[model samples]
Every structure is written in structure tokens, then in C-alpha cells.
Target: MLPLGGSHAVAEGQAVLLVAHADVTTQRLTRDTTRAIFAMRQRTWPDGQAARVFVLPNDNPVHERFVKERLAVYPHQLQLAWDRMVFSGTGQAPDRVRHQAEMLERIATTPGAMGYLEREYLDDRIQVISMD
Candidate 1:
């Protein structure tokens, strides 16, 4: 079993939850690919699907730490990358959700929505993607 309240516990296929205002295209991403996509590196899938990322609020410690340690990128770097994309009119950053529950709800309803969540919280409506 994975430990609680630490970065190690969140691994591949563990269902990372994301939230938005009820519209976005993203769901069930590989852990490494998700990390890359979130960092704004991998823009499209091998199948030619556009990668859409949804992120939690910056203030959330879990979100911050995950990006820092797992992605090996700072939040400011993510912002800068996103800003650059926006300025260039390439693609904007993923939408944001207000809270975990909201993220779950929005991701559940939205097609192609991808997000992370604790494995314990997963349900039938949400499909967990393996980070392994």
C-alpha cells in the first residue's frame, strides 16, 4: 500500500483529479506524458491528439510539490511557459478548478478531461490512468 500525505504515494494510474468550469478536453494520461504535457513540452499525442492540461490552484501544497518534485519544474517556470505560449498564440495553459471536489465533478462530466486524484477516491465515473 502507498503511504499517505506525501509525493511518493501518487504514482502511475492513480487517478489525478482536475477541475474546471464544466468544459475542457483531457482525460487519463500516462504519468510521464502527463508530466511532460503539464510542463508544456509534449503538445500532441503520438495519435495527433492535442494535449490539454488542467491544474489545481497554485496555492495548494500538494499541487505545488507535485509539480516541483515530479515534474522537476517550478511553478513560475510553468507560468512563464504558459505565458509564452499565450503570447505566441500557440496554446494556452489548462483550465483551473476551484477545489478537489469541483475538479472531480468537472472531470467526470467533461469529455477528454484529465486530472489526478488519490486512488482511494476513485469511482465508476472516473477512469484512472496508470502512471507506471
Candidate 2:
């Protein structure tokens, strides 16, 4: 399981998890697919529901750790990818949440919404997704 409960999630080495709305059927995603989803390249879940991506600010430590450890890319690289997509008019950026609380609340309330969170913040309202 992804580590949780530390005050400073990433700085203390407790990486956050990729989470989704409780009703979302997708329990596992390939790393490439997860990356695509956050990159806003994949528009729908494999189950065919439109995916709504949520993210903490790029400068957030949880966001940085998630990008590097889980997605295998730097935060700036991901930002650049999003920027290019936005500028090229091929896609838009993920919905940005102000903090982990907002990230959890947004994902829990929005159908097909997905985001990352420290495991301490997890509850039944959202489900954790595993990446291969």
C-alpha cells in the first residue's frame, strides 16, 4: 500500500496515492495510462466514463513526489507537457485544487474524478487506485 499519515507527506517519504471517486470501477491502471490521464491525453476511463482529473498545484511537494516517483517524471516536465497541450489547443489542464483537502473533496464529489492524496486523508468517499 502507498505510505500515509505523516505531516509532510512527500518530504518525509510517505508518497501520496492516486485516488478516484468511490463509484469509479477502475481499480488499476498501467503507469502509462495513469500518466496519460494526468497529462490530459486520455479523456475517459477504460470503463467509458469521462475522466475528470484533479491536481494540487505544481509547486506542492506531494505533487512533485507524485510526478517523480509514481509517474516517473519531474513536475516541471509534466507542467511543460500540459503547457504544450494547452498552447497547441490539443487539450486543457487538469482541474487544480488548492490543497489535499480540496483534492479529496473534489474527487469524492465529482463522478469519474481522479487525483492524488496522502493516505491519512483517505476515506470511503474515495477509492485508491493502484498503478502497474
Candidate 3:
């Protein structure tokens, strides 16, 4: 089986659990939807919720790899897209957290924020959505 802690599982056809600050939930996102959200390509979901995102700090290789391999995009590319969006006043990038612990803490405390971690760290405080 995959490692145990960081990820979440979302039932099919249900709203993907977005664990961010209350203000951030305005942007509800799915795993596929988040690729565009993070890439700054799609600004909002069909429901008109602005896509709010949470990210790992630059030094976190696990998150970087997740984005690069799973999302099929590189960190620099994601950053560049965000820069372009911000420059054009189209959209902004997701907020960044320091590490998995901080990410989990923030997600648990916040309402609409969504992020990822290894499968081993999950707890009762937040909901974990399965990607597939």
C-alpha cells in the first residue's frame, strides 16, 4: 500500500474536500481542477468560486516532486504562470506553508484550503481526499 499519512479520500461525485481558510473555499477545486488552478490557467470553478490554493515552501522537495510528476508541471513554470496572471490582474497564486506539519495545521484550521502530503500523516482534524 502507499505510505500512510498525508493524503485525503473524496467519494466519487461529491465535492472534493478543500481544507483552507474560510475565505479560500470560494475556490473549490478537484485534483484535475487544481492542475489548472495552480498553473494559473483556470481562475474559478464552474460554480464561480475563485480557486484558492495552498502550497509548500520552495525548499520542500516532496511537494515539488508531487507537482512536477503528478501535476505534469515544473515549479518554475507554475511560478511563471502565476507571475503572468498577477501582472495581467487575472489571478494570483496559492499561499505557501512551511512544511507538512504546518500545512496540516493550516488546512485543519482553515476552511477552503487544499493541499497534499504523504499518506502517513493524516488525522481526525482534516478530511483526506483520494486523488484517483
Candidate 4:
């Protein structure tokens, strides 16, 4: 579990929560499904809505924590997968946001969007997605 009250980049530990647009029908996802979506392998939610994935920079600590702790992979591995998908024309990378604020704004406004956030950064504009 992520600890409470941290800095923007996470201070020691993170309670990064997977979040989605307020109107999304799906409330929970399995780890594999979440990983596939973020890895650019899954294109739609279980309810059949197109999945719009958002991500932070490869070097961001929050991203590192989310990728490693939640997704069970290193940041570089995810990046390499994205690079291969882009170069081979098999797939594309997620929409890259600058920070949590922008990630919140984009996911809040865009339908079928999904991303991660520090617990304190969450607002009613988005819905917290539970990992099933």
C-alpha cells in the first residue's frame, strides 16, 4: 500500500493509484490487463470502450514506482517495449503527459482514459480504479 502525504515526486514511498475518467464503466482491472494497457498491448477496456493510456516521463520517480511496484517491471523494460512497437509499426506508445497535474486534466476530460496518480492528487474529477 502507498503511504500518505508525499511530495510531487514521491517522498520515500508512494501510494500510486490507478485512475480513470469519471464516466468509465469499468471499475476494476486485473494486473495483467492493466499492464497490457500501459504496455501498449491493449486498446480497449473490458466494456469495449477504447482505452486511452497516459504516462509520465521514463525517469520520473512516480513513474518508476508505478512501473516497478504496480506493474512488476522496470522503467527501461517498458520503454524498450514501446521503442520496439513504434519502430516495427506494430503499435504505438501511450500519450505522454508532463506531470500528475496534466495527467489528471487529460484523463478527467478525455473519455476512456487511464493513468496513475499519487493519492493526495486525486479529486472527484476522476475515479480510482482498483486492481482486481
lDDT of 2 at 73: 90
Q: Where is model 3 more than 4 Å wrong at Cα?
A: 1-31, 43-51
Residues 58-105 of candidate 4: C-alpha lDDT, one tens digit per residue: 998889999987798999999999999999999999999999999999
* For model 1, the run of ten residues with the poorest summed lDDT: 15-24
Model 2: residue 81 alpha-carbon error in angstroms: 1.2
Q: Is candidate 1 or candidate 2 better by lDDT?
A: 2
Kindly give the number of clashing pairs for every candidate: 20, 0, 25, 1
Give per-residue CA lDDT, model 3, range 4-37, as digits (tens).
3354443321222234443442333456766876
Candidate 3 TM-score, C-alpha based: 0.67
Task: Please give the TM-score that candidate 4 achieves against the real structure.
Answer: 0.90
Q: How far is 41's C-alpha from truth in model 3 (Å)?
A: 3.7
Query: What TM-score against the true fold does each predicted structure earn?
Result: 0.67, 0.90, 0.67, 0.90
User: Which stretches of model 1 miss by more than 4 angstroms?
Assistant: 1-32, 41-51
Higher-lDDT candidate among 3 and 4?
Answer: 4
Write candidate 1's Cα lDDT for 52-80 as tens digits. Answer: 55677877665676576656678788888
